[model samples]
Target: MDKPKAVTAAAHKLARLICSMLTQGEAYTDQGQVCCEERYRQCVLNKLNKRAQQLGMTLVPAAPAAQAG
Candidate 1:
């Protein structure tokens, strides 16, 4: 089966995000850094929501995966 366009677009976005992290990712301790972290997190959530809508799906946080002993 062919991949859905929405998923392909999301994959492209995620790939770009990964590249950006490689160049800009770092731990920082400051108010501005904390705000930036929240901003980026929300931006990703927005993208996911958009994609989910496009695919006629709902988006929700998943429960933590169970770990095998």
Candidate 2:
């Protein structure tokens, strides 16, 4: 498989692992209930962003609303 395909597959595997861990309540830290939600979000986002760039797609930030004339 190519690099892009490999990355995509790895991302999917990571997502599935995260889901399984969540379902089993094994995704929390040792501090009882400390969740790494933000870390997971960043991980997924970073992977997707990298994939998008590799695909030659520009990930533009949302545009601000224009001021009324």
Candidate 3:
């Protein structure tokens, strides 16, 4: 969707979350940037893996880089 619709949809989601938290008497805790970034990375990887499996292929993790001599 376009920017306006996307913003509205996000606002609705945030409102619902806030409402649920209030009803449960819970506090809102921000999962810092690192946590959010890691979650997003995992989500992308999961989607990529699923697509690869559908194509009869597998994803292999890259080897750690070697230090310069």
Candidate 4:
């Protein structure tokens, strides 16, 4: 497998692990102070962005907010 493929696979695996942890309630404490959701989100996003960069893809900017009428 090539570097890109390896990176993709690793990223996917990491995402799945994070999801499992969250779903199984293994990611946070009762008081919600130890929430892992945000950390997981950032980790996945960072990995995806890194993979995109490695594949020569441009990371798009966040969409603009809509104005309420």
For all candidates, what are the clash counts? 0, 0, 0, 0
Off by over 4 Å in 1: 1-31, 64-69
Backbone clashes (count) for model 1: 0
**Pairwise lDDT winner, candidates 1 and 3:** 3
lDDT measured at residue 1 in model 1 versus the true structure, 0 to 100: 35
Candidates sorted on TM-score, descending: 3, 1, 4, 2
lDDT of 2 by residue, 1-69 (tens): 999999999999889888988889786335432357767777988888999999998676689999999
Cα lDDT for residue 69, model 2? Answer: 100
* Top-TM-score candidate index: 3
- In candidate 3, position 22 carries an lDDT of 89
For residues 1-69, write the lDDT of model 1, one tens digit per residue: 367988999899878877777789854335788889999999999999999999999898999999999
List the candidate 3 regions with Cα displacement exceeding 4 Å. Answer: none
Model 1 global lDDT (CA atoms, 0 to 1): 0.86
Which predicted model would earn the best lDDT?
3
Model 3 / residue 9 / CA error / Å? 1.2
Candidate 1: deviation at residue 37, Å? 0.8
lDDT of 1 at 45: 97
Report the C-alpha lDDT of model 3 over 3-68, residue by residue, as the tens digit: 999999999999998998989999988889999999999999999999999999999999999999
Ranking by lDDT: 3, 1, 4, 2
By how many angstroms RMSD does model 1 differ from the true structure?
11.8
